[model samples]
Target: MRRLAAGVLSLAVAGILLAGCSPAPASDDSPLSAASPAPSRSTVSAGDPDLPAMPPTPAPSAVVDDAAADDAGERLRALVGDAGRPAEVALLGDSFAAGEGAGSYQPVRGVADSLCHRSADALLADAAGTPPSPPGTAILHNLACSRARMSSVTAAQAVEGHGPEGVPAQLEQLAGIRPDLVLLSIGGNDLGFAGLLQACVVDTEPCGQDPALRETTRQQLLQLQAPLTDVYRTLGAATPAPVLVLPYPRLFDAGAEDCGRLSSTELAFGLEITDALNSTIERSVQAANLPNVRYVNALEDSFAGRGACSPDPLVNTARFGPLLNAATSVPASQEVLHPTQEGYRVLTRDLLRWLEENPM
Candidate 1:
């Protein structure tokens, strides 16, 4: 393991803190099936995988671009939904919102240490827990699965590997809850991006040098745009509140030496595909223009421009330091391919800020 720099970044990244608040009962007390049983999953992971520390983020500042700032503010206003009184807020998608590692709750809080990664019930509980309002003021339903796909977002899509129901079934279940606001994050599984990224790590051939494989991946990524467009339309039309679609986070670490492991070709191809997918999503959201539909700039805030090759990759694979836990008390693995818990915390904080800045 390499020696990681010990600074505010390292401390924030490695040190895990439990909130001073006590754990709430794992059940929703809201009107929308506040007592619904948790979803059943045959196989489950123990707890969230510990993430590495990150450099401290600069304080939130104004977005310089006039148009970008306007757009962001507009989106935030829309998200708050009638002064934060949205009728129903349903969370939809894959593992990002499912709280997979955190185990099921009667009312569903988020996965431990998961920031944006939350179940609908958890988000609603958080919203409700905000004082003045009890949880469940708005219906919150989570329809995300661990390894869901773009097709999964479609009405009748099926799960190929495991699980009793498909994403559409879950969505239908959410529809039953009749939410007013829907937060969605999906498509990674469909593109098989994660698997391909792992392959890129070990491939002996220079990355992106594999034109044939590159083209195949590119087309698949492009294909994902269509499903995203369709799902947005479908979900937007179903519920009264506008739908908020979130983009995937970049899975590469930035400024780390191991990043050299990824050839320029691989990095280029990864960026190209991810960007294209995001572009399509933005356009589709605009074209649809549903009354309550909106786009949450997940990629733009945390991942835009900064990819695996940027100064900071939230999901990095590069070696900054020990790459593993320094403390013998608990062994930690620095897997740069996923958001470190710290990275996710940053995302969560930003996400909340984004919501504040662009409340619907």
Candidate 2:
């Protein structure tokens, strides 16, 4: 996920940008509290319980098996270090991993709870119920920034070598540490797809489903493939551990029509953009197939038919409180289209299962 805050907001929340890695702040506005500002451990369990349960435990899912589970276990064992002590695992991505909007003490297994912007740490904490520590190592790093794009990874010092412009540098750094694994979440910025979709809604005919808009969506998606490929290729060569590239969560509050404020035309436009983006992701992953790279199709599972602007909503989008104004309230973090902590839980669970199935 991309960082949710820019400017002063980023500075205030920068402490929470995941553990281990830190980047120079970007010049953007303060992150709105809507971004879950700064999450610490206490906040994880402190969330709204009414939130939907993550998909049923993976053990029962036909999608995974004992072998996969074993693989995941092995991989974790290696990541943790000798005798299962906390080791080093790098989280590379935008704010989605930062657990924005979730509050302070962002938790992640094997790492201490504080303000670190790492979705992986949150995932680990959410999955394991505690942060991993020394002997028990904690080298969690979140290099993502609010406006950070694919290029950001290669630039910042915290992730300078890993920013888009620093791929070669990142590769060189990785060759030395030879990390156990990497969590890769990117691509949303490459197409600037979200802004484009919003523009389509504000400027054009929502209901018409204009061919021009569709084509624009299609072209941007096509363009992203090459850059994503570059990212995958670089990771494949640099890291021996498996690289998990999280998919973009579904966009569009499907139940948006209920709000009355968002016309069906607008809802339809949002859904159309969502569909196009997902299609692009699936196709790109299929075509690329970089070694040691796996595209975790989290978006397909989370948003599916229940997505924002979905044909059906899990909650009434028109109502206030948790489900308010699907058109506006459900962006996960301000400006950044991502899953909420409730959403990240879904990813965490899936990763656990995936790890279980595919150990190092």
Candidate 3:
């Protein structure tokens, strides 16, 4: 196992402190059934001999133009629906979907609020209550938890472990409900991103120069394809709804200089990892070949000028004291890598646009 840096450790401690101050549980009015019992699976090996060769990862670029954004908005406005007949939507995955960096997290009924960290500010939250146009509501069933891997979608497991002993599988939360759409943002934890970031951001050594870490990350990336393919296939078979798989956005601009705690070299290394993770997801979706399952490429275009190093960043990049002391304060270092409330808003915009253009 990799060693965590002092800064990262401190961030973890800070998160725990923040969790203690969270408010009481909210109403459990979501359109989901009782949780299903966890399922068993064979131990996943590092490399599966049956897997095929993956394509080369694409270079990071901003592909969405102003005309595209405007066209998407127009399409959304044109959606026809009966008044008060809301669309049933389900959300699943890890920190990104749960809104870790975005503040105002909503507490689960039976579980500790801090464990799942499903923020009211999450993109799905915005989409749930508010439809693309007026009089068209979106009722949501969110089962996203922080630190969730692909396995967490279908098996009971210990997640980020900040506030609860264990969490029920996300799929279990969707037992009897048939949603119109399911948005999933997952697979980063399987890559062991927390540990990788610790080494890159908090440690003294440049991540690019660390052969052992790089090799390990590469191996993990290779191992992820089979399991990810399996997950997509399972979700496709289980749900009649269209399952949209959202990939992680680029956190830094490779061509730009570092801004905040991350150095230029460190930013470049992080970008490489992000690309590899996204590539793996895309390849796995293709391998699944489910017509109902489609990959969302909104992040690349939506996050164009909003990396950690950008002049107007969607993701957080502030250092400790300044971040913690701000009027709209962010608590920890882990939070720094995640999308802010503004970032989530931008994500929601892109998602709605994509959904409008590619109607199911």
Candidate 4:
């Protein structure tokens, strides 16, 4: 994390965080992250070795041409809803940000490995709502892959091994594609939230009360400030298009006593950690203070009764029956802990609402 935050030249990247102040249930409880580390058998391993810490980032505009700003604004206005001009939206982030755990997935390219479970049914897949798509109105170019980190956006990556040269850097892709909007979700994997969840899933004993684990994760999250600020700046520098960032809605209801095998302490850990994550992201965006970034930033509250263990779980939960069963055909279990189709639909609705409220 120190290495990730050291380098500076941009504002923020495949971003995560929100607006809200849900209190932690206990002093010992710590914040967690939004990414899921597990990869499908056909995909690449979802891990990136930590880079040595780099120097702090400079101003995002330092590398960008000042002349592009007005051009960008004009481009956005001219293209949006134009009968002949198509508006493109670029998406970046991890499993939570991608179409993971929801809808059908796009076909993986070639025989090469990729963790990108990019979904054809993704929330942004249809920018103008139900298809037949507005002719030259809006299009979605989902660059998000599962387990992508802050660096993936700031630096060029090697995961999407489709063609001989492979995919370009996501940030660069934004410049080349020059979409009207960019949506991001990241930071969970960087904080190693996967390990914390693994601790909870593998052990019945509460993992939330572990002071060392909580503190360590908390510190790592704080380190994200600089890099988060840089990436958003870099993103802002890359184009005049607006950036819309979304937070992962709560997985388990914080107020709920338990979620399946998860105890109250475990539940509290998830809830508080998520709140911290969103708050951190919101603060970073504010620090960058770029005019183009729009985060309806709040600790997600709309999906209150629709948590993982709720009567109506918008997010997918563990399927112990499938895990323990010998002959049950419950399909695959890759979507656990992520959002369901319904969740994606609702989030899409919220995103559109925010867009409506914050027009270009």
Candidate 5:
């Protein structure tokens, strides 16, 4: 029965990859090449009961489990002194924070809302490079979901939750739990990532070359400044915890000779988009000026030279193939343009480095 379930799970997970990961297109036919700006995206606001009940998932990944268990032993061995309390950490935001792109959801027992595409290899669970503290050092509440946006994550709603199963906003969930730390990565959806994907991958025209489109995107992103500042303020006021805002990595290096299926123009455009995103985030964080809220340039260096166009890309391309589990099943469609497990590992390594250098 277990094996059978696993097989079924593999097929279902593959459904995301095999079918394709295109989001509903924007109103303007040419997303990036359009004469007019694309409209803002709709997020999970006010009980977004659109999706059907989630598919069953395989058991959690063993890599994290083993690492956790070993860390526990190490902790036991080092119990003579300085046994600090575990930090209760909360993760909030979209697919990046949810680990949705790392492949294959892991069903955490009693965590129904975790069907929000939680993965075992999300950065916090295990350190990729050097040991920063130990594994299992923090009590994690991963409240991130695929397709999440600013509206879905903040405490703006009057109601309890904005999504299925009454899963409250990430901030609301964190409020109830009173975590000691928070990690957030959002804003891409607000800028219409899906539409951008359609433009770059689905369309034949050189959408990237359109100066008007780029300006439109920039204008849209700029509009988020005030609201983002407010969101940062809300977060700071909500908890005494340190809020580390992580910006998304550039999906392509844009300088490499080979760009897979992506044209050079598209890759260059991707770089521009990422730069704009990081800059927006940094500015917002700075404007917030809260001692607790800090921005981490998490992937700018680590992801360099390892873009979708590179020979050893960390980010996934549309329908290319799975990085780790090619034989078992294809990658999830949500994994498209998302970081692979290895990519997550690199992120983990960078995060650990940051933590070590700047201990709170």
Candidate 6:
């Protein structure tokens, strides 16, 4: 019976993907192509009731399952390979690292209204759990937050609804603690990925086809190179630990017809934006020339045939219907373009391989 239900669900999903591939009618004007500039950040109200509520911060007494911990330890041991001492690791960046769309977020410490969106299911959490840290050593300090921008790392910014006052800068979280490695997945928010997706998918007109809007967005993305470079330089100088910058993966396969709400034009535009973003990040890292900093090409060829339109996509295409429906305001689930748990695992596998090849 369960197998039958699963098969039905699979067919439904496939039908949706197929329907999305049909050519959409053109509109005279698209909301995305409006002359106005895109908002600098996400507009979703932090206090929106529809947003998923994260769990309260677990007390020390809330122990992780022993069997799971043991499994994680074994995986870490295998990855490290005889490096008895586990490497101290920290995770920083935006929703991707925070596991926003992956499901199950960890509550903010002391702030009941917070929506920082840190999740135990995040890849960093998985990586941290896999290794057995020496007694008294912190294995991972995940400071990544939903809608985090480059400014979040550089400035003392307040998370909306998190607290009355602006929270300390994200970089400050690393002030005193020096980890062996810092994995960063940021810059997407800065490029306004969520807004772009909404504009392209939800609007009556196809916004991605507008040359003016595309150029404007491109220029804005290009402008980020400087700030991104600064971040790498700052992190490298602040800690001796190596910084691995994970660029956003290509969400769609080139030449694919469509995936759910994402039209072919939208997919092409999204690919361009993603490529530009990745290129900008790579360029910034190269210009910085920091010995401790390196860009991880985890996205290149990683999702290859398995884009949003594929039978198996690394990204979350399952939420397209809900996202398009005005009635559904599921929080964090709107984390369009973000990876699934399976996607993160793929990324984790690549990351582990990278670490194995490049031993510190």
Highest-TM-score candidate: 3
Q: Which lDDT tens digits does candidate 3 get at residues 1-360?
A: 124334444354233321222211222211001121111111111233244433333432333344544443233334422244666677788878878778786666554545566777777455565224344455666678776778888997574443464677878877867777788988877766655655555566766567666656667777788999999999999897789899887776656675545577666666666666776787889899999999986664356666777777777664444434332333344365678887777777777766767777
How well does each candidate superpose onto the true structure, as a TM-score? 0.57, 0.58, 0.74, 0.70, 0.70, 0.73
Candidate 4 deviant stretches above 4 angstroms? 1-84, 108-114, 126-137, 156-167, 322-334
lDDT of each: 0.45, 0.43, 0.62, 0.55, 0.57, 0.59
| lDDT agreement of model 1 with the native | 0.45
Report the lDDT of model 2 for residue 50.
44
lDDT, candidate 2, 266-317, per-residue tens: 5544444444444445455555677677766543455444444443442123
Clashing pairs in 6: 72-130
lDDT of 4 at 268: 69
- What lDDT does candidate 6 reach at residue 152? 78
Local accuracy of candidate 5 as per-residue lDDT tens digits, 159-247: 11333444567776776776666888887776676666445544457667676656566566666667777878888888887788987
- Tell me the tens digit of each residue's lDDT in model 6 across 1-360: 755443443333321221111111232221222233222112211112253322221111112343544355345445442355655677887776777657666666566534566766676555565235564333666777776777778676566665665656778877866677788877776666655555565554666766665656656655677888998898788888778888776667667786655677777666656665676777788878999899885444456566767777777663445334412333433444566766666666656656667765
CA lDDT of 65 in candidate 6? 44
Global Cα RMSD, each model: 15.0, 12.7, 10.6, 14.0, 11.7, 12.6
The best candidate in terms of lDDT: 3
Q: Per the 3 Å backbone cut-off, how many clashing residue pairs does candidate 5 have? A: 1
Lowest lDDT block of 10, candidate 1:
30-39
lDDT of 1 by residue, 153-233 (tens): 555444322334432455666656755467776665555554454445445675445555554554554445556677778
Between candidates 3 and 6, the one scoring higher on lDDT is 3
Query: Which portions of model 6 show Cα errors greater than 4 Å?
Result: 1-84, 130-138, 318-320, 324-327
